[model samples]
Target: MSDESNQTEGPIAGISDVPVTLTVSVGRARPTVGELLSLTADDIFTLDKSLDDPVDLYVGDHLVGRGVLEELDEPGSGRLGIRITEIAPIKDLV
Candidate 1:
């Protein structure tokens, strides 16, 4: 088959720039009622994931990618950000 025949159209060209929500999951924890109620300002709750593990990214509820968490330092701008490590296949997003 010719190259042109093998190539199918991709997603609608105009919608690529649309905004979407991307989530990064560090981990999950189940807290008991007593634990939840006893929480204070200095309390720290541990998550299931470790520092070296990659975080999962989600749009709405569907997973779209995975990335690593990073901290940024630029004078007054101290924010946490994600550096996408791997993106899910196009088929998977659909």
Candidate 2:
């Protein structure tokens, strides 16, 4: 086998079949029924993460990367600003 035969593809593109754990934001807890009802006019529920805080990225039970959430102007169209911290090894042979 020649070296050229070992290197042919530029990149491998496909779907990832890995288990991941994502931490979702619950925002502020509702105080009371009256207070919750009163909160209507201009209510802003802030996420748990701060602007400077690095969001934790996990693959199954392992921590692999961190990303920031950026809001999009066109409604719910935000993207995950990912910074890959580690390259996780694919276990189970399939």
The best candidate by lDDT is: 1
Per-candidate total of colliding backbone pairs = 0, 0
Per-residue C-alpha lDDT of model 2 across residues 1-94, encoded as one tens digit per residue: 3455554342321333334465533233546688777787788655665676666655454655455555645667674344444443444212
State the displacement of the C-alpha of residue 78, model 1, in Å, after optimal TM-score superposition: 3.2
TM-score of each prediction: 0.72, 0.32
Top candidate on TM-score is 1
Candidate 1 TM-score, C-alpha based = 0.72
* Candidate 1 lowest-lDDT run of ten: 1-10
Relative to the true structure, candidate 2 has a C-alpha RMSD (angstroms) of 8.7
User: By summed lDDT, which 10 consecutive residues of candidate 2 come out lowest?
Assistant: 10-19
lDDT of 1 by residue, 1-94 (tens): 3455555457644465568877778899888999999999998889999998999999888888899978778755769888899998888876
lDDT of 2: 0.50
